[model samples]
Target chain A: MTDRPLDPAVLTPDQARALFRAGLSVPTAGWCAGRTQANLIAVPREHAYDFLLFAQRNPKPCPVLDVTEPGAVSTRVFAGDLRTDLPAYVVYEHGEPVAEVADATEYWRDDLVAFLIGCSFTFENALLGAGVPVRHIEQGRNVPMYRTSRPCRRAGAIGGPLVVSMRPIPAEQVADAVRVTARYPSVHGAPVHVGDPSELGIADLDAPDFGDPVDVRLGEVPVFWACGVTPQAAVMASRPKFAIGHAPGHMAITDARDCDYIVP
Target chain B: MTDRPLDPAVLTPDQARALFRAGLSVPTAGWCAGRTQANLIAVPREHAYDFLLFAQRNPKPCPVLDVTEPGAVSTRVFAGDLRTDLPAYVVYEHGEPVAEVADATEYWRDDLVAFLIGCSFTFENALLGAGVPVRHIEQGRNVPMYRTSRPCRRAGAIGGPLVVSMRPIPAEQVADAVRVTARYPSVHGAPVHVGDPSELGIADLDAPDFGDPVDVRLGEVPVFWACGVTPQAAVMASRPKFAIGHAPGHMAITDARDCDYIVP
Candidate 1:
């Protein structure tokens, strides 16, 4: 079957989800322009409480937008089927990636609880709107994410180092970026660290634990925000028997708007 | 044993908790002046996920501060023992109030999960600091709280109408009150309804579902904020088999400062 001619940036959230449901696989960065995109994670019921508590304790890295009831597929924010609508899925077993599949239906469980976490994409758009340059997007690369020395508060069996994503902001625009992004607390909020990466024990900016690296110009400063990968890091460390996540850069387009999460 | 002479308003949080733990029972409104006071709710592990989901869905009425592990009695926010640290406790049997006691150690269960929710006491101080008169405090009465017509989003078995606490603010200072309180989102940030009582389906201004009613003067407008009583209302409506909460007005004093919750 041939894919439809579509401009992801102009498509409505429902249209994007429909396209994804029809098996068109693509990263969701520019999709459904004004809507919020979410990172997905599904874990068995036995581990749901721990994961929820972990997210509660480490809210910066896990700003949960919505959590589906055990075994349920849809939520108020995401009207599409959880098992098949996302462009890509990563299935984990005992903390290790066992498969990357286009459809998660066969891996889905009756007792699974899904969490839709806020992504930095929302804040990046806000940053750009506020005239703050986003290095990764400008370079046409992924944001660089690093595992930090600081450990998140542990909840039950879930515990791991905090992870952060970095962006090089022009010296004068640093404050503007912070003010703009701080408005979206659900989407990682303000920068976790500014100026130095060593403070977070991130020794090298060029070698990120995940995502691609970007150049930091002489007049720019590297600012870091809490990354959504922290929860996945905890899942890896704690080794839950089963877990499912959207592949990096592939997000669940939700019905909620970017402005829905903005604080006054 | 003779009670020690102390000004409740001047005591530190640790001191306040010690006083309560030593069997002194009093409302915590004036205690721990700069620190945050939290509402307590403990339920069986079987019902924890639903309660957490409920809090997540209805953040305005149920701003969660900290949640303890099942069977645990302490958190980073509240270092004191949960079962005995509060000034008063109310035990619930099938959502009906079964007992109100000074100490809850006798009824505490090993499988209970405790949730510490943000209370309006924090924002009330901010309002007073912002030159907004809180009539209930001046009259030495409990802040009036009402059950509203609006229903909170349901999560699993936990769902109920939104509950709001009213304060009479002079029309001129309404904006100031909103700006000051909005800074503290964890404590039910900003007013949910302003001006008309009929809008919220609150039939009488003098009668409230909880707390004592305060007089709304001619130039003063009634401003309603999402109340901490909401989760308890849900508990009563859902009728869980067993639950425990701090008796109304009595609270668990936590280590976090009220300023720690304020946003830019």
Candidate 2:
């Protein structure tokens, strides 16, 4: 309720979520240090099966961390209310953006099934911990993402192309980046493509489809990891009756630690 | 098909499936040595959302490898027909077993959705490669499975207690078994319990609820891994209108290699 800015890094996940619930709208790039963040997507129960199948088929691009039962307001990993906990939400009607709102209670439905998917932001900390430079975080810009030539396997009524986020890492540390991120399989594990953007049908590295593009630098290689934007892309392509998702970079922070997902 | 008994160890997955498709019914143990095997469960589309939610909530006991679309007969990892490829099937009506048959074609419904859950059988080969002794395979008996006291997180209409398969490992080799099996998360991951059976609310380890009992040596420790029987146990407890599952010990062999699921 005060007029001063809050420091995201030092706040607890509950504190950060409380601020968002109180109508503070901002991208959650860095919040609650080690807690995991998630991409949100809520759809009608009628379309839940198709969406679940879509995620099961396309795991790299859509690693599902948690799923809520119909009309449920919370999941196992997230304790806050789904209707008002996230900083922002995009309401979609027949796959078209109908409204962007801070609170989604007015548009929430009793039969909605919300899915909490793994976000790349969860692995960025691990990357930095391993001494791999993340260009976007260093430049204070959003990560660059692109729509690829790869088409995700269609499930029932859902389908779309794979979307990838780009991070320019030094050529010498690219393998280290892969090793670090591969440990967290639930969060966009490992880079899908390295070295060439043309192989993924991405042109003009400076012009990204979503988010701000960062410098590739002289000796850095463009490393691409599957992005969380994939399900939204699928929502647009499939044209479902109704859908809801977290606004770009405005994620739902969960209580799970980054190490919880790390595998052997 | 000839009446002569065939050696299963050297056969390809497709060859093994062909034998099953031609009415050869037997447990898939040791068949197609290096290939992955799965537990099959098919349910009506009306109940799929609940089932998918159940698997998501209880991942250890129900590690989903592949899920087929409603009315579809195959999955990405499974190329054979769901109706006739598997060796044997148990058809259920209102959760009660109505019939056991060689082919499920007559009981197959267009609205059915099939799920390929990861079985402990897939990890047994890796355990052997790591020098961990497998008593069940050595004794030519099935792995002993029991119902634990811990209840699984309930999803809509599905709820049940956790089911686990027990394996006896030498005290020195228990760590190696855990390390080796931990690499394959898709195959029920690591051990849920290491030593005490009484802690899990089981009175006697020798009297198992499913599969045959195996001996535990003087210096060996009993290790428990989440079993694939958990989902079927849920179905039987919840009593859905219709369900189909693979007969005990009979499994569906997949084309995926054991190394494909290994993590760093």
Best by TM-score: 2
Work out the TM-score per prediction: 0.95, 0.96
- Candidate 2 ranges beyond 4 A from true positions: A1-6, B1-6
TM-score of chain A of 2: 0.95
Q: List the residue pairs that clash in candidate 2.
A: A264-B264
Candidate 1 has an lDDT of: 0.87
lDDT of 1 by residue, A184-244 (tens): 8878889999989999999999999877899999999999999887887887888999999
lDDT of each: 0.87, 0.87
Give the TM-score, chain B only, in order for the candidates. Answer: 0.95, 0.95
lDDT of 2 by residue, B146-200 (tens): 9899999998898988989899999999999999999888788889999999899
Q: In candidate 1, how many Å is residue A242 off? A: 0.6
Give candidate 2's error at residue B66 in angstroms: 1.4
